[model samples]
Target: MDAKTIYAQSSDIKSRTYLEYRKDMKKKAIAELEILVWLKSKLSTLYPKQKIKVSKSSGDAFLWFLRKGGVTREPDYHAMIDDKDFDIEFQYADKIDLKYFDFAISKIAKKNKKTGKREPHQDRKILYILKNNHSFAFFNPEWVLKNGKIGFVDAWRKDAYRIPRNKFIKILESDPTLKSVIEMIDVKNYILNFQHDPIGINKEKLSFLLQQIIDEQKIIKIIPNDLDSFFKVCFILDNLNKAPQNINLWLVYLLSFISNKNTTEDLSKIIYCVDFLYSKTELKYNELKSLVNKVKECFKLLKSFEQKDGSFKSSVNLSPIDETRNAVFSINLLEDLTQDLIFYYKTKEFNPITKIYQNLNFIHNTYNLIKNLSMHYYIS
Candidate 1:
């Protein structure tokens, strides 16, 4: 189905119906629960006779089990615990905010120190369950408190894991067929390790990963695969101190490669790079101005090709060809130009050639004249 038809169909669905459907789908989705159960089962199976115990501390009633005194049983069962069995308590709530749990865990770890043991007594075993229907265990207090507190902690074990809502929804919404595709991606360890330590993904590694994925031609073929990897790469890029030169180049390349696949929001993200560059102090005005000019030219070309209203044809490529994708690309280019023009007016930079005050009035007048007209249709 085309975008318009899909959008219309979605609009026809009642909001409450859609929401209830999502809720029901989540309940039936065994992927998350399976992950939790698998982890618990693995630990027990690893040392079946070693007095290992598992418990579901979260709101989920199916898998909450507690292990104590070499016995494992349902958390509600009081038979699994004894005062001498290193009394560990399992608490489950609607949502387990890690920040609060870390604080509580830290207090417990400090108070339960063993004199003869190399590590703190509480450090030997600690676990918590969170709202996301996952369980996390801490073996060493030192490791748990590595970065001082859970909230302040960096990547756990240098692994990044989280079911980011935006990316997840984008994937499902973009390709309804990819529900299973997303499920296949391993996220259990990522979540488990993330709870203990935040993932420490650097720009270079992220860039390399993105390039590798793109080179494999996997992303372009499968929307789910590309969207997942693309967002992950973008997330890492978004958090960086600055977009690395190599990463920025890669992004530009990706943008060009996907020009034919332009969406309004996708184009917006690409335009965001322009705004980011303009906002930075690192790049000189002259450098930015030159880049902006090039973008402006691109926008002019795109404006020429755009049909009436906002939509463009999909045949346009990044080349000089008259295509709709090029036109959409121009929309972002124009957005950046407007931003720069506003900036220049605010800063009052003297025009080297015109020798006049670069005030808001002049900028507004120029923008008004050039703004609405299509770049191709407008004859200068």
Candidate 2:
């Protein structure tokens, strides 16, 4: 859809238009999902021999599988291994709990089933399977599989823990065999932290490290390398908003790395990146306001889809986590808009044509109604 069309539709101000918008959004979301599935299928066929396993299950399927296998709900496993020869004896089931596989492998050694004793096995050549485009694997701190070759693990941890970061990076760059595992590790470690700590790593240090690794690579392998990537990255980055953390360093590094040309196509990243910068208490109000204005423009450009019931679906094929997060993000944005309206009112800055006050009032009422409806769904 064109920007003008979205702007015109979104500016209708009538409830009927809002409902139509939401319905259209849902349709768009479904279309996007179909396209993504088609693309994934094509990619899979291209790599027919890859060890990655694809599952059609929704998010609940993996959890259900683990629960059926008698795995505990709490994260308790300490060791994991993917090597076929590495036979880890377990009291329960043959398959490890997917969520806790990393934790499990880190803590315990593979054992023989009959003797219940640790067994020495090949440290290299781990196996991984794909589920719904995401990949998972098992690894131990002492050893890792790289390009079908066994090698000692090298990576670093925050505390007293020692990992082979240099070796890991080297293998990741040169070894195609270990590429999937490395990517899986990066996705798990980085993507999962998007909500809690997007800027957890020091910006300068991470940039330097990433650059060094990239320099050694003949081809780069970052996924979703478009506007979608920016959204995913920014979504993770914004999760760092509520803390005492200064994400400016990280934000700067990201902006520099991604560059201006690539980011222009996706102003949402710019809006979010600006928001991160303005959020710093040290930043001047004028500077922050400029960023906020940029965000407002970006928002104006955003396509709003409405359902028949006047509710909006901000995302398509949203996972449980995404649904919860989108709701929270929408509510938070509305709250911010309310705060701005109150500020304007207090300053006697009246503008009937802009209709800021009226819009804010409508938003408040809409949000409360939706929240009440949500509660009813849960309670019923």
Q: Could you estimate the TM-score for every candidate?
A: 0.24, 0.24
TM-score of candidate 2 to 2 decimals? 0.24
Q: Write the per-residue lDDT of candidate 2 for residues 66-140, one digit (tens) a residue.
A: 201232332211112222222211111123232212213323335578998544344322222333333323334
Please provide, for model 1 over 1-380, each residue's C-alpha lDDT reduced to its tens digit, 9 standing for 90 to 100.
11111011111212223222322322322233433443445445534655544433322222211111122222221112222223233322234333333334332344335563322334133333333333333233444344333233253333222323332222111223223322322222222222111122323344444322122122222222243344443333334322334443343443442343454334434454443433332334655455545454444444444444433444434322223333333342344345344444332231121101111123232232233343544554
In terms of lDDT, the poorest run of 10 residues in model 1 is: 1-10
Alpha carbon RMSD to native, model 2: 22.6
Against the true structure, what is every candidate's RMSD?
Answer: 23.6, 22.6
Q: Supply candidate 2's per-residue lDDT for 226.
A: 41
lDDT of 2: 0.31
**Model 1 TM-score?**
0.24
